[model samples]
Target chain A: MEIISFASAVAGLGILGIIFGTGLAYASVKFAVEEDPKKIEIDEALPGANCGACGFAGCSSYAEAVAKGEEGIDSCPVGGEELIEKIADIMGVAASSSDEKKTAKVLCQGGNQETFNKAEYQGVPSCQAASMVDNFKSCQYGCLGFGDCAAVCDFDAIVMNDNGLPEIDPDKCAECGVCVTECPRSLIEIVSSNEDVITNCKSALKGKEVKVVCEKGCFGCTICAKKCPVDAIEMEDNLPVVDTEGCIGCGVCVKNCPTDAFVEVDF
Target chain B: MQELFLLFMAASITNNFVLMQFLGICPFLGVSKEVPTAFSMGLATTFVMVTSAVVTWLVETVILVPLGIEYLQYIAFILVISSFVQLTELFVKKVSPPLYKALGIFLPLITTNCAILGLALLISMEGYGFIQSAVFGLGAGVGFTIAIVLMAGIRERLEFADVPKPLKGAPITLLVAGIMALAFTGLAM
Candidate 1:
């Protein structure tokens, strides 16, 4: 329109524009990295939970593993066997199904009914701390009942009961072990889901001393161990240990406990 | 070189698109729950940001200035940004279909990402030369990407965190953002 002052503009900025744009275009082309598309797909096929149960840091690394053909099939523990099987089908690899059906169970049954507190705990009542000095309660191996495990469960698998104890919902728990790591007292343990009987009491004290402390406390009495017909129960550190395979869910041990410590959970 | 480096750092941290400028908070909060979604959104925004900056600069310098239609900046920028996003969407679809799908519906949603518009406005307002403006836009995009991805990582951990009931949802996120802002203070110095 104004004689198209193009010559003047080119004189002012055309060379600079050309130089910069070309430099950028070159950089964009030169620095481009070829990324595999399947890496993303494999990652999407993953449960997207990022539960960190697969030994990898998160899902992205798991996706990288799936793409690289390095790691074996079944890695994501939270995704479970079904997800691993699907991933194996996608990657055209053999599915390594780990049949370990484990669920987190609280070892301590010393609720408000059983335990007495030496001192009132205030501020971040972690089980680890309760285990240090004067325990929040009298029993050393009892649940601090601070609900730390309830706090870390991604699924609503845990609810703190009225007695300051966390009850784990076995169906909702994926056994990611986040709660296991989060618990300070180490009272939470993973046992086979099929295991109907486990010693809720982890204390090693014996006889009347343990009975005086808590209503649900187990004294290291070998009566349950000695009276077992299948040799499943054994006295270890004064506490009766039930071998999971040998435990046929028989209530013989429950019937024999003098302190009502070894109550049958399923029976 | 110092100007370029300082511009890069300033755009990335001192004037972050997500946390500082609060430019792309929609995608920052929305798509940041998962690393994959957050990453895809960041990458797509980066792509859109760089493209719009280049085209808008060209339009502003070549056509608008020459034609004395500088008043048409907001309209011109919007039109160019929309077309550029559409083209980028098509390009991503053709070039990287999986990423396109991964980007999914968020691609279209990014058309509304104000960070792109903000970059266009800032570049035009600052009167940066084409390369400087493009660099600024890229820096803003990278800054946005960094913010959202870090947010995603934190949110993943937060899913298992024992945050209080009163601090759930936006309250906790705001607290996290405040902490992140405090963390960013180190970079500002």
Candidate 2:
């Protein structure tokens, strides 16, 4: 009886396996979807970061778009230049060197020391949370210093400095613009690395209010705008907007600004 | 009729597969990110659970008990459950392309989901008849759907919430799951 039971168990299981195996094999062939071979290849070739930096859901969706010729090969910023070349080679197209390497610029210089607090914000230690609850920072338009931008940066390129402002490492920044969207005050901007000048402040307050708020606030004294030899600086809403096309990188604005709101880009 | 109704309610709510029993947690957490996706996963799992329950019940009664090899129940149940999952995947892919895309890799993952196996084992362990096993499986699946859908709704809201930095992603999700489990205890009369 024991031997018969053992044989029955083995035979029963073995029969079941064969039945399931055949059933699955038949179903797979019967229900096969016609997938694009090139899409699979492109998916393998592309960096599978799925960061949504390319405006797609993930690497697979992006690959499908590229395979269908719906998206350009240069759309992926996280992959950088090498991925572009690889994709171009797969697609049988000449790789366009269209992307200029960019870096994130923190437009606010009003760190913890530079600005006074209107209230002691004891809420959640996130920029979004701080900004929503009356923004304790004296400058309403400055970095909240809670490192919301730093938190979203997938590349680990952003760090909160001693003064509670984000310091971006240019070398590691992929310019994916995730940090740009993360900032509650929209203080972070992606700019061409080769740009010679950047405004270190985003304060829109008038000269008097600016003085009351932050030492580093752009008081709109119009010194840099007046000093611009090529009329590259325009005063808009009590802030100096630098026009890169007409600006000569002479560092005149950097030198002339009393509050030192404009600084020459180091890199 | 009353007994069947009670059995269904107990399986779906009081003895909920995901919340109360804590089976099939992988998909419960992984697929509960969005409402639509979570609903789809729940439905797919429900279909598999019901079918596997009936099939495994037949296997236990007709084959294992007759052969006096009830110890082979585990392997036999696993084989039956995995095959049904594969068959379901094929049917879903052929019938609805959008759902197939939405489910993505999760469709195949149901093969390993312990909830279906647990239902099969529970049915046989309780010596339930074929009709009773089927009803129990359906109830268990409905229970899973409710738990996952609830989790997804809360997670969607949590996206905009000011969750603390340390408890942002997985930690907060686990905390929410724990809280949900505690809340479900209220239904356990």
Candidate 3:
């Protein structure tokens, strides 16, 4: 009798479990979302770094975009060329390789030795906070003599030289733009490192107007503007804008600039 | 409805899984330092918990009991949880790409998250019916979310304040968690 009772108990549990299991399986399948298998394939083809370097949230999102035809495959900066090829092959499309590999270079030459600091800042010495609020230093456009750029760099390409200015290592640069995004002064720019030379100074005020507040100020002095033989350099609001298309990497502007603001990053 | 309220009360304050029981502490600590990240992790964990509870209840009721393979529950539960999360991830990625983006990697990582496992175990151990299990899972997830998010907001503010050397980093955070647990313990009465 006890054996029969035990068997019945087991059977009771079994039937209850079976009923619940079937119900659950039904709900799971019923509520189950329809997902594209192609997105998974594309995601697998991606580098899976989750770096968010491609302006999307993550690699999976990028894959979904590729599947829906919303995004091109080459936008991933960290994925490089090989991953691009993998993605193209997965999609059964011919790989488009027109996007040139571009590198980032700092346009300005304003190191600590180049620009004079008004006073030694005691508090948070980060460039972002310094740019946001004036410190003991008098100038507003000053690099704040802080090394926030050096701090956030993932590749260790940027280091604070003894002069209290960030110097970029030519070989170590991955062109990740952490520094460009980190800088509070908007001092960092993603210029084409390979194309040609660039003007670093962002000062718009003319020579006399700029010189009073800053010693390193590039006064609307059009020295580079007058010297460019190809008319590639244009002087706007005391700043020199180079038309990168026509300017043929001529050494004329670098030599002519009296403040020496226009210099090569040696990319 | 009453069952859901009871589960909510239990998960949100009284039985409080994260602050009280200490399941799923890895993400609670790692991701809780930032508000946005902690919030997203909480939501993703909740979604996984609710779904897993429903599925595990079914697997136990239907597959194992009838066949008398009751001993295989542990491994079977784990297998079902992982595969379910993976299938859900793929499905969500295809249909709602935006949700997958917003949730980030936590969408897939929650498969191994112990909180989901614990919720499944808790419901089974308590011998909860289907409705009771769902409510309990929902409550537990809410509890976890509340704990992590509150910690995140406090940590963000704490970043500006000057903290002592020994109490800096993990130490201070843990101390804060203790205080939070103490505070939530008051909810029991």
Per-model TM-score on C-alpha atoms: 0.55, 0.65, 0.58
lDDT of 3 by residue, B1-189 (tens): 776787779876797998899987766765677888778878888888888899889877776665556566776687778767766765665567687666745655566568888888888788988888877888888888899899999999999989998897778888999999999888884
Docking level of model 3: incorrect
Candidate with best TM-score: 2
Question: Would you list the C-alpha lDDT of every candidate in the order shown?
Answer: 0.74, 0.84, 0.73
Residue A50, candidate 1: alpha-carbon lDDT: 41
Q: In model 2 chain A, where is the ten-residue run with the lowest total lDDT? A: A49-58
Model 1 chain B, poorest ten-residue lDDT window? B100-109
In candidate 2, stretches whose alpha carbon ends up further than 4 angstroms from where it belongs are A1-7, A34-101, A108-166, A179-188, A196-264, B66-68, B101-106, B155-189
Off by over 4 Å in 1: A1-38, A42-101, A119-123, A263-267, B1-25, B28-52, B59-114, B117-189
Clashes in candidate 3: how many? 11
Model 1 whole-model lDDT (C-alpha atoms): 0.74
Predictions in order: chain A TM-score? 0.64, 0.69, 0.61
In candidate 3, what are the lDDT values of residues A1-267, reduced to their tens digit?
Answer: 768556755665455456546655765676565567888888887776544445344566678889887888787777789988888888766643544444445544555556656666665667766665544544455565577888898678888878666777756766678888888766777665555666677766567756765655577678788888999888886788878888888778888777767875465
Model 2 chain B poorest ten-residue lDDT run: B102-111
Q: Pick by DockQ: which candidate is best?
A: 2
lDDT of 2 by residue, B5-89 (tens): 9999999999899988988776787667788878877887787788889999988888788877888899899888878777877
Model 2, C-alpha of B111: deviation from truth (Å):
1.7
Model 2 root mean square deviation, Cα atoms:
7.9
lDDT of 3 at B41: 76
**DockQ of each model against the real complex?**
0.08, 0.28, 0.15
